[model samples]
Structures are given as structure tokens and as C-alpha cells.
Target: MRRTVARRLAAVLATTAVVAAGVAMSITNASAATGGVTGYATQNGGTTGGAGGATVRATTGTQINQALCNRASDSTPIIIQVEGTINHGNTTDVSGSSCDVGSTLIDLKGVSNVTIVGVGAGATFDQIGIHIRESSNIILQNLTVKNVKKSGSPLSNGGDAIGMESGVRNVWADHLTLEASGGEAEGYDGLFDMKNDTKYVTLSYSIMRNSERGGLVGSSETDLTNSFITYHHNLYQNLNSRVPLLRGGTAHVYNNHYVGIVESGINSRAGAKAKVDNNYFEDSKDVLGTFYTDERGTWQTSGNILDNVTWSAQGSENYPAGPSMPSTTTVSIPYSYALDNASCVPSIVAKTAGANKGNQVSDGSCNAQSPSQSPSNPTTSPTTGPTDPGTSPTNPPGGTNLSLGAGADGSSKADGTSYGNVIDGNMSTYWSPSGTTGTVSVKWSSAKTIDTVNIREASGTAGNIDNWQLVNHATGAVLASGTGAGVISFTAVSTTKVSFVITSASGTPRVAEFEVYA
Candidate 1:
């Protein structure tokens, strides 16, 4: 059956190329928006086909590389909708090494606004995965990348199924099945990795299985500035380490399922903070919060369920301790998103996580466009956290760091001061507007009482916020107004969200801390 399908696919591809030899080829509407990162990366939140652009159906490695290079040279957004198997037989190792030499790899370097989507059953990149570097605004969906083993090549791209590095930003990967033959001995590295200041990426509804290594963010501990990544509704199975071994970035990991983790999962180190929420881990060991090599890491967990987890020895290699629910660090997604209860994760994940052979995905909650949607017909009731996320169950004295792990957003983002940094418990790090004046906001799933708000300015004199007003999201009322980081006191009100709108500033005001306390 496999051989017959391959023969048919090869003949179709040959005919496609021959038919388009002398004529202008146009893309079909295969690049329709599939939600998640693809929607987020676009201005309309709608991904279109390579409209008004050339479309080429690439089957061999050379044809794929040529098509990509042609689109890249124009520096325009394109969609390279792929079909059939693209393997090492058609690719040459551009790494200039002997290991996996003459093997083909899809290297998207220095390109912008490109979408790679699968057509037909699914597009498979065999023996090599896509490598993205120095690029931005890219989307990859409905593809399978496997068997990427680089033997004898010490100078490879870490042999990852999909690797992004060096100023890469605004990427979305969805519905990908990235796998390997065995471990590093089998010549495969991480399934997905981002390093060297990669930011604003979301990996959703993907499957990574049967591999020794999972993934990593920030190649070194000193790579401090790279951050703002999200991992949601992914299935990680039979992995040993680097369940995204984060170094210095902040990651929002939610609704992911971890099964058969041999050694470790979610290795957070080098001052990285992982906001873990509503995930499921079963038949796995050391599922969360392992600090690897050096430097301590921090994680805040809420509504996570663990079952059949056998923890290993907890000392030496594992630093800063295991994954535990801390009092603070309650996360509120600033964007509209969906969640599936841990009890129903297995059922939903089985149908949605991997490549749907014929584009018939029973994606379950993974496709919910609203933040309030819960799993439909869950097998069991959703588990609740020890405390309500935003509300103080004890109602103790002015609850601690209400904004510590809350979801944050801003009118504009500039430099390395992201919206997440405003409430990240680090005054040294800040969130600045691209322009001199803009709004910065924080959100919560539930309402809470808040009376005090503090602002630490990145610039004390110049670039300080001269005039500002705090607005309530629910009532559309102005709560407080002040200038120049004055400690503002307001009547405590229960609200889901609030924002500080800056009317005037001395210069580009950088907010180091936006602390909300109740």
C-alpha cells in the first residue's frame, strides 16, 4: 500500500511540474487560516494562500530549495504548499559537513512572512526538518518531519526536527508530528528548538514522540533577552530531557499532555520562569521543574493534574526542586484561547495532536476560538486548583503580587521589555512602548479586589510617564490618574482586567514594574 501510494504521488508531482513549466502557476486556497499562530501572525488573523504569488508543488529536495530561495530573494510573504515525500535523496547538506552530507534540508534563512502548509494526505520532510534563522512572521502547519539524524556532522543545526535561531520571531507551528528513530546515538537531536533571541512563538496542537530529546529554548544561560514563547495543547511522549529546557526565557505552558517521560520534563533553569497551567501528566516521571546543568529556575503552577508519576532522586542534577504549585504566579491569558480539562485531555489529544492523514482533524478543544470555552462532554469533571486563580480564598491581608504571573498586554512592544516583563517580579526588566506613549495592561480570569498600584520607571527623569489614567476593563470607568510614578491609591473594585493609558511622557517611558496588590 505504501509503495503504491508513493508511485501515484510521484507521478502526480511529475505531471504537476511539467504542466507548469512555461506558464504562471497560481496557488490554490490551501493556505486558509487554521487558527492558533497562523491567525495570530497575520494582521487580519486570517492566513490566506500565496495570493497573487507563484505556487510550486515541490517533491524533490532540489525543487523545494529552489522554490524557497526564489521566494526568499523577493523578501515577500509566500506559501510553499508542499506535497509527497521530501527526503535526503533530494537534499544536499548545506552545512558543508560530511555528516549527512549531500542530504537536503529546508533552510529558511533571512526570510520574512512565509507559510509552509501541507496539502493532500500530509507533507512529510524525511531525514531533515526545516531550519529557520534570522527570519520573522512564519507559519508551519499540517506537516510531518521525522528521521532527521545527522551522523558524523558535528557542525549540524543540532539535528532538530524543526530548529529556529538567531533573531527569529513571530512563528507559529501547528499540527506537526516530529519524531525520531531513537536518541542522539541514532543521530537525532531535539524535536523543536529555538535559540539566540527567538521570541513571540507558539507551538500548538503538535505531537513529539519516541525521541530521547524534546526541545530547548535559549542555547545558553547567558541568553537572557530572548523570551515570550507559548506551548499549548501539545503531546510529548517517550522523551528523556529538555521538555523544552528553558534557559532565560519565560514560557507559558498550558494544556499539554506528557506521557512516558523517561528522565525529565520541562527543564527550567538559568532564571527561566515557566507558567504551567491546566496540563496533564500521566505515567511520566519528573514531569515539571527540573533545573539542568547550572543556575536555578522558577515555575508557577495552577490546575495541573499528575498521575502515576514516579519521581527520581531529587538532588544533584535537578536544581531548585521539583514542579509544585506556588501561591502566586496565577496566569491569565491576555489573548482569547481555549482549554480542555485534564480529565478529557487523553481523549481529545489522541484525535487532535498529530498530523491528520487526510486533513480530517477531530481537534476537540484545541480549535476553540474563545477563551471561555471548556471541553465539550468531558469524561470527568475538570479539576480545580487549591485556590481560585485570581481570587484569594482565604481573603488574607491584601493578597501577594496579584500581577506576578497574570496575563499582560500592551499597546506596543519595543526593545526586550515585553508585556510579560511588567509583572514578572523583576524591577530590573521592564516593558517599554515602541513609541513614547502607549497603554500597558494586565488581565485575570476572575475578578479581585485591588487598592494599590506601583510603577517603577525604567527612566527616572527623561521618558517618565507624565500623565496616565487607569481604566477598568469591565465598567469602562477611569479608576485612577496620576503622573510620574506617583503611588496611586484607588477604590478597590472587582474587575477582570485593567490598563494604564499613558497620555503624555517626558520621553519613551519604560515601565519596569506594574505591581497590582489587593
Candidate 2:
């Protein structure tokens, strides 16, 4: 039986029930009209059963904390809905009169499956957005958290927009916008912090502007995929930090577009293995800026850097702190075509591996080098002719292109010939009167690019075709020969020869068509 592959899809559910509960609870616990401070709380009704159950309604950070400390472990998820804005006058913005740093907006501990969405449009002047500790399965999606002071006072660590302590897991943070417009010394540190054993987390499709340190910091095993992370995309005029710091775990970083402003695109460390593929990095001063080595003293390694276009790395520097091990510090730019910059060159300098094995720069130019040839064997001609007149013409026709047709066994062909003369069965053999001692002419009309054509002994298994040859049709030279089917490719040129010959075969050889393209 023939084989084929299939595709997979993911699912998304509506938030109607969760939103309805929030609306009903908002009416009963409405705050006072004086615009001072109030308290409200609700829980997510999801059946997945984690810590995503709270909605709080404390205007002041102090009031929000008091409400959270009073909730039972299994009561329900708390939704902290701030009724009105509370402007504390303290500059530290933690626990005083200041709107910036009196108390944290919401502090979550030992919670799971909890989400904190915006209640209304004008929710503003909050303290730190959400502080999470030892939480799992929590989602903080669709909230506009801004004007957060990084540091409360002169001798403290700046408040992060969303801080995840040592034990967070399986967290999904999406569609969040954090604005830290405070001074450089007093601004927030990072938008999202995943440090100390935070595993199986995803930070996707969020925007951050003007953070003092960076955008995101993942210390341990984490997966950061499908995120639009760019300094230029953020509304801030000046970007002063790195995009993401992948410290541990095998991070899969793909499909992200990065434009650096002040630092490199990614700052990986401690022998992290990052699969960075299909990403567009444009005009970045640094790309893959710095990294640490593994326990074996091997520098930070990348899994595969496939199909990434780097516009410029003008101010970028390779790792090793000053390049003591020149071989270890050198970067591999695989499948990258670098233009301008004479020093930068394509990873695959030539068409084959032998041409690029040990050659170096000469006169600032690397010319075409010869590739190795395959082992030679006796060449033979096909012992068979076309099964029908349309495919094999006995008499000479003036410039009429001969085309193969569908075999009698229901195998479709471009030429549409309908006959059973062509052999189409396992262990089947057929021979034509048309034979050449030195060469064989096989013709077919195909719009697709023909790569490697295989001649298989039809009786063998799919992977065990007994007689095969790989011919470069453009150069008209036999490239390689093997035990299985024939493999042919178009070498920057087009051809109509869909046929091959087996000099000798352990069993009767059968022909099949295979095509490859650029």
C-alpha cells in the first residue's frame, strides 16, 4: 500500500461563560461613587481545574492584598477588578500614598488556571501589574499594564510588570502591553521574568516598551515560539535591552521577527541549545549576542539556523569574551546568503561539500571548486522501448514530441495513453526492440522539475529497489549508482529524459519517475 502524511490542528474555546460571570459580579460589588477605593473578586468557571480562579476588585494595592489573603484555597479563582483608579502619592509606588508604589496590583501564590483580563477600557494608574509566586497553569492575557515603577526607593530592585518567581509552570502570557516610561534608574526591569525552574511556559504575541533591563528572561527550561518580539515594533522611541535571554532548556525559537535597537536579538547563556529557524532579523546591531558554554566546556550551541535572513550585524561581536579559541568562537552561518561585506560568505560556498571542505579566502573572492565524483561502473542501455506508439515512435517524425500515456493498470500519465502493453506489476519484466549499445533514450513530458529518476526491480520492497543510478541530466554525466531505485535531478537546467538503464541487475529492473526542485 502507498503511504502519505497528514496535518494537525489546535483548538480554542470561547470565553462567554467566564465573561458573563464577571459582568454579573460587577453590578453587586460596585465601588463607591467617590472614586476612592473598593474591593471585588470573582473566580473562573473553567473545568480544567488549576489555580486560574480569582478576580480581585481592590482599588488600592493594600486593599487588593487583604482580599487575596482572605480567600480559601479551593473557594474559586479570584478576579481582581479595580473599580476606580487610586493615585498613591509616594514615589516608591509600593506601600505609601504614591500611585506608583504603594502596593502590588495582584499577588498570586499557589494558584493555577487563573486568568486576569481587563474589566473595562479606562483601567489605569495601577501599581505593579501581577506578581506571581509558586503558581502553575496560570494565564495572564489581554491586559494593558502601564506606568509601573521599576524601583520603589533608592536601594531596592525595580518592580517588573509581570514577575514569576522560582516555581511557575505551564503559564500562557499573551496580548499584554507593558509601558515603563519612568527614568532609566527608576524604570521597570523586565516585562516577564521566568526564573528558577519555570518550565513548559509560552510568552506569545505581546508588546513591551521602555523596560530598563530587557523584554523577557527565561532562566530554566522554557519554550518561546510564535511571538512577535521586536524592539522597533514596540511604541517606545528608545530600546535599551535584549529581546530574550534563554538560559536553560532546549528552547524552540522560530517564526519570530526581531529588530534590535540597543542590544542583540537574543542573549543565550549556560550552554543553552536553541532551535532558531525561519526568523527575520533586520538591521540589528547584534544577533545571538553572547552565550555560555556547557559542562564539557563547549560554547553555547544552536540546533539549526535554517532560512533566517540577517540584514546587518554591524556592531555585533561573537562570544568567548575576546576570542581565545578561534575555532570554538567562530559562528556557522548555514544556508545564509550574505550580500555586501566581503568578509561574510555563504555557508555552502560551492554546490558540493568537497569544494568547501578546507579552502580559504584568496584575493577576497572564492571561485567555483570541483566536487567529488561517485564510483564508476559499467554503463548500459535500456533493453526496452515505449509500450505505445505515442510514447515510442518507430518511424522518424519531424520535431514531434513523444509523450508517455497512462498504463492499463490505472497509472495516470501526462500524454494520456490508454493501453495495458506497459508492465505495471511487482516482479514484472518487459523489453522493447529499441536498444542502444552505448546509450538509451527515454522521453517524457512533465512540467515539474525532474531530479533523480529511479530504476527499481519491481519485486523488491519500497526501500529495497535493487538497481539504481543518479544522473545529472544537465551535465549529461552519471552522478552515482546504488542498490535501489534511480535518482535523477535537474542541475539548474531543464530536460525531458525521464528514463534510465541498468547495466546489470540481480533481478529484473523496473522503472519509476521521481522529481525534485529548487
Number of the top-ranking candidate, with TM-score as the measure = 1
lDDT by residue for model 1 over 1-518, one digit each (tens)? Answer: 01121223334334323322422312211111123231122222222223224556666666666566655343554567777888766765343211112345677777665667777666898777788888776677778998776674432445888998999877778778998767777678889998898887778778887778889898777877667778877888767778888887678887787766767788888777788877777666677765557576778887677766666555776653344545234444333333455555554455566665332222233332221111110112112111211221222235587888799996777766689978887655677766434678889988978887777664333224555667776765667754556456788888888887664343456677677888
Cα error of candidate 1 at position 378, Å: 33
Model 2 clash tally, residue pairs? 47
Task: Write down the worst ten-residue block by lDDT for model 1.
Answer: 371-380
Candidates in order: C-alpha RMSD to true structure: 16.5, 24.8
Worst 10 residues of 2 by lDDT: 34-43
List model 2 lDDT by residue over 1-518, tens digit each. 11110100010011212221232110111111110000000011111112223445555546545544545642344545443453343222333221122243455666554444333442343454566667654555445566566556422124666777666655545345565654356645666665655554544334554544455545432433212111111121123444566554444443233322334345555444444433333333344545332321122332222222232322323352221211233222211111111111121111111111221111111232321111011123223323322222123223222223422221122222221223332224332211110112343455334443323222232332223334333333444443434333334435544333232222222333222322
Q: Candidate 1: TM-score?
A: 0.62
